[model samples]
Target: MPKLKIEDLARIREQARRATLLREGAGRVKITVHLGTCGIAAGGRNIMTAVLREIEERNLHDVLVTTSGCAGLCSREPMMTVEVLGQPPVKYVDLTEGKVKEIFAEHIVGGKIADRYALAVGSERVM
Candidate 1:
């Protein structure tokens, strides 16, 4: 078995806590990345990493990141959504690392929506 270091334990705890937050989804903002077969092929992981890094670097502890299956929009496989307590959950299509950073700075931190990539959730059509 591999040895578990203190840092590993802390990361484990943090991930567990994040999972719980996604399941609850009541008081916090949850960011879910659709990672189905198509999603991964479309740079989903890159977008995910960028978003996570941005959140961590900016110290946005209220946000939780989760993963979901493909949204059935392969053309927009790298799909994501940002849900806040009092706002409608909005999805973003065709995510890229650069767009993730822009979303973080312009929307997440600036309280503005990124219309360029904003897609409607729970719909077959892309916005």
Candidate 2:
């Protein structure tokens, strides 16, 4: 394996710092990806990776990507929650890599709340 370059390390550190700064700001979007065993088994890692890549690709310093334990929705593994500023939080279920990309593009970036794949929005709200 190749050694990690200083610049690459620095960029990663920058991104991590940027993630924190973005989370602290007034205007930002928070994305929570479920990374429990079930979620991981269902490609949560891919979703997480895609989320980070999309933020970098779009220069979206305002989107914060993070992970959490399972919510006991194994059937809906690879679940993700999107909380855009001043908007309701949306939980999307049954995600695949392709769907993750589409979410990043259409909903995360384009500001369109995708209803087709959504499982829930908040407490006791399912779609």
Q: Tell me the whole-model lDDT of each prediction, alpha carbons only.
A: 0.81, 0.83
Runs of candidate 1 with Cα error greater than 4 angstroms are 1-27, 121-127
What are the per-residue Cα lDDT tens digits for candidate 1 across 7-123? Answer: 999999998875565466554577888889899998898888998899878867688788999877789768898876678787899788888899888877787888888977344
- TM agreement with the true structure for every prediction: 0.73, 0.75
RMSD of each: 6.6, 6.7
How many residue pairs clash per model? 1, 0
- TM-score (C-alpha) between model 2 and the true structure: 0.75
Error of 1 at 7 (Å): 23
Error of 2 at 52 (Å): 0.8
lDDT per residue for candidate 2 within 35-110, as digits (tens), equals 9999999889998988887777888777877799897889988899998888888999998877877887888888
RMSD of 2: 6.7
Give me the displacement of residue 12 in model 2, in angstroms. 16
Q: Which has the greatest TM-score?
A: 2
